[model samples]
Target: MDGAGSGVWNDGSVHVDDQVGQGVSADLAAFLRNADDDRPVKIVSSVCGECGGRVFVVLVDDVEGGAERVCTGCGGRAFIADSAEFWGEADPGEAGCPCGGGEFETAVTFSLAADGPVRWVTVGLRCEQDGLCGIYVDWKIDYGPTDHLLALA
Candidate 1:
């Protein structure tokens, strides 16, 4: 979970460790591994802050929208808005899915500093209609505002 040696993937995909946590599917992992060089990127946290859970449900409505990560164990939640200063991108929802689907399922991961705050975050999206998965977006937290970004998990 250390930040060192992170964000170095040759592909733009974010690295997700399914062994440390559960819920990420093999197909989703494969899609992330082979992500296009130009695709968006982000990490996965090993433990939940509330109730010590290891499972979470993620949601991403649009590129210009915020995302939510909810802990299944205790119903704890974290939210982040895409309008945050760290994110500078247009809304990708206007383009819709390549298959013309408008809905998507989301997955999120984070790179944590060994002894500090969160260093990075990656959000992944899967098309509800076609099962296609890819990076939705990612951000680098240089200022170490873990609570602001994670909402204290």
Candidate 2:
């Protein structure tokens, strides 16, 4: 949280505490550290209905529309009707990792700005077993995760 929403470190990662993606993701984590208690992030560990799979979800926002997810098992796709519900975990534990094998490795750096006007955030998870890989879309209908982040300022 040294330089939230600011510069980059020697390693090339953002200066913000990467608490959500580990200890090294974005300034969102630094903001989350000071987030309001009333508006806590709503996180869920959903079991894939098609394959009975547990996942560590990374959200992806579709600027044109809603949220989407690709199943790790059946390759089935699921969409969250609300695009704002999904938010990154400040602690960003390993439990959300879709890959159950050998510790989930980063398939990609899920950024909060990828959604453009929609401002959707997406994180990637890769599983060594069956190569289970996918993202979790923040589909919360009640509130905007991005808005909440902005409010933190």
Candidate 3:
């Protein structure tokens, strides 16, 4: 239980089956890996969907997989949304995109356990005006402010 609070997974960990799945195409992965200003796993944090708590990922190397959680405070389980649902709207300037583009796009991928529970999520942000982007992973803690509007829907 050295990292009981923080677990480590691979860059390609999809499906609860425990094998490995990148869940992203080669080109996209390459783009993120080569982002100008940042590494893929730089800063990935999220809120606990169960109780609205912060869950920051301590990624080693480049594990893009999502996180599975048993809400310690609420005694319930929570999951990260798939990349499709995890995308957040932001200005490239705010995200530190080197392109300084007017539009930024984020794509995420969610991992689900075979038992039908979600494990974790990976996110990639890119500047639509150019292709400057970055990548990261975070716990599916909650619908954080970035996702508050979506959570309401």
Top of the candidates by TM-score: 1
Q: Is candidate 1 or candidate 3 better by lDDT?
A: 1
Q: Report the Cα RMSD per candidate.
A: 8.2, 12.5, 15.3
What are the TM-scores, per candidate, against the unseen true structure? 0.47, 0.31, 0.32
> In model 2, where is the ten-residue run with the lowest total lDDT?
36-45
lDDT tens readout by residue for model 2, 35-136: 312222211223345785544233344333333444555654444433333423222222243334632222222223323222323333444455544442
TM-score computed on alpha carbons, candidate 1: 0.47
Clashes of each: 5, 12, 15
Residue 96 accuracy (lDDT) in model 3? 37
Go through the candidates in order and give each one's C-alpha lDDT: 0.48, 0.33, 0.35
Q: Residues 1-153, candidate 3: write the lDDT tens digits.
A: 111122333344211122212233333344433442222221123344567543222111123333233333454443334333333421111233565543333434333333333344455544545665465444443333343222220
Model 3 alpha-carbon drift over 4 Å, by segment: 1-26, 29-93, 140-153
Sort the candidates on lDDT, descending order.
Answer: 1, 3, 2
